[model samples]
Target: MIKFFRKIRQKLLSENKFSKYLIYAIGEIILVMIGILLALQVNNWNEYRKQGQKEIVNLKAIKNDLQHDLNTEFIPGISYYSKKNKDLSRLRDFYLNKEIIPRDSLLKYFRNNWGEWHIILNKGAFENLKSTGIDIISNDSLRTKISSLYSNGYPEIENRVNIVKQFYDNEFGPILYDNIILYDSTHSHDDFDDLKNRKQIGNRIIQHYYLRTWLFERSELVKSKVELLIGDIDKEIERLDK
Candidate 1:
């Protein structure tokens, strides 16, 4: 093509056709400009596609991280077992010694304490997501759903925590502390025998308690949310793969 254009120009120059050569030269300049513009457009398109694909990769990573967090932090099945173990040990000591519920207020105090602990753990997980910029992206539906879940869900948790805290402040701490001090100083009567007698009842009550049930339910809820997040990530990955 270069040789073909050069031959035409050489022929025009040999003939001394200055007007025709000047016209051809102007046309050639316009063609070169058009070719350059086309090349630039192609490059810009490629860059845009690359950036879009990179965004998808980052989104997938964030989704996977969210799923792992949900599984590790929110799933309370393992934690439930651990708490039960410690509670069982504490109950055993109380019962084996026939130690009466040193003060009627101890169980009440524990009930509130357990509730607050669950709320605090849940709140921490929710806040972690919020601490990142997970909520600000305008177009991702799944991300928005997860963000809304944390935002809306958190107020309920906060309210529950407040109730638990109020109960602890008003009722449990003073009563339990006073009795714990007296019992420690006095070497109180053997209460384990009494505890053993009521072991079955205590176990049943623990299972039915609101704190345990609430934690278990919310744990499952978060697990489901995490699974949905994973599913969304899978879709995005497949899209990018294509």
Candidate 2:
């Protein structure tokens, strides 16, 4: 192609048609410029396409995080807290209302249901987006929503759970060890029926009920938010695929 163009230029120059040669030269320059522009355009398009694909991958990864939490973490958390509340309610019945409940059942509830559900979120993808650039998300509303959920919503729940965990670790756990026989349900504690110890343990169970109730509501809200976000991400993915 270079040789052909060069031959044409030589022929035009040799003919001494200066006006025609000037026109041909100008046209050739325009063609070269056009070629350069087209190449640059194609390169720009390729970059845009790659970035778009990356955005899709990021969205999918985020969706995976949300889905995993919804199914495994949040859903289970909601159920766990609900059960906690119920068991605490049962304990409250016996302690507060003086309901005649069996010793074994009460002990089982106290011993087995005494744990907190720590929040285990998958923030890897979100952190990756932050590391690269959150603007990579493209959608303004989605970017804001996601940032809010991770930075604000998720953290709020985490803080609540941490408080519950701390209560168990620092305060309530020792009380349980002192007032309740955990390993052996049949073995009663020295102060199991003492008025002071009964009130203390009863008050703790009531407080636990409230905390678990709070956590359950929060879990439900976060789960709903995650589901909505997943839907939005699915739409974005479909749009990008197009």
Candidate 3:
């Protein structure tokens, strides 16, 4: 094709057909421009396809991370904390209402349930997404929701956990340590010898009840946010599959 065009241009030049040669030259330029444009269009399409594939891969990774959080963190965390709350309620009734529950039973429940519960979110994919640029997600709504889940939702839950932890460490823990005879397997006893002291600490336990309730509600909120995130992930995955 190049040789053919060159021969035509040379023949036109040799015949002193400047007008036709100029027209041929202009046509050649247009063809070259069209070829460049087509090449650019194909390159653009390839880039778009690559980006789409990247988005799908990221979405799948994010889905895996979210599922891990739900299974290994959120769901189990909720259950564990719910049981702790119930145990606390039972102890509260034992103390506040002067319920006739056995001392060993109450102490066992207290020993088992008392501790700081932390929510370890699976934010590996999320952190990577943020570092790589969230715009890669493509879907504006989904991207925003993902961002909110990490930035707002998870942090809110953590803040609640911290609040409860601080109260436990600074107030509740020391009080309980001083007042209650913590059950040890090596030196187990069924006697409620410190019942008077335990009753004295009941006022402090009642004071900390609000923190427990707040933490439980915040855990529920985290679960709700996680569910919403999972739903968005499912929708995005379905979209990608299609």
Which candidate gets the maximum lDDT versus the true structure?
2
Cα displacement (angstroms), candidate 1, residue 214, comes to 5.5
TM-score for all models, in order of appearance: 0.51, 0.86, 0.82
Evaluate candidate 1 by giving its C-alpha RMSD to the native, one decimal: 8.3
Top TM-score hit: 2
Worst 10 residues of 1 by lDDT: 179-188
Q: What lDDT would candidate 1 get against the real structure?
A: 0.55
Residue 181 alpha-carbon offset, candidate 2, angstroms: 2.5
Model 3's lDDT to the true fold?
0.78
- How far does residue 27 in candidate 1 sit from its true spot (Å)? 7.2
Q: What is the C-alpha RMSD of each candidate to the true structure, in Å?
A: 8.3, 2.8, 3.4
Whole-structure CA lDDT of model 2: 0.83
lDDT of 3 by residue, 1-242 (tens): 88999999999999999999999899999999999999999999899888888888888888898888889887887787777777777777777675656644767756865676777777888888878888999888899888888898888878887887888898888877875667553223434545534655676576567677887787787778778878888888788767
- The C-alpha stretches of model 2 lying farther than 4 A from their native spots are 98-105, 183-197
Model 3: how far residue 35 lies from native, Å: 0.9
The better-scoring model by TM-score among 1 and 3 is 3
Choose 1 or 2, whichever is better by lDDT. Answer: 2
Once superposed on the true structure, which residue ranges of model 3 sit more than 4 Å away at CA?
14-23, 98-104, 184-200, 238-242
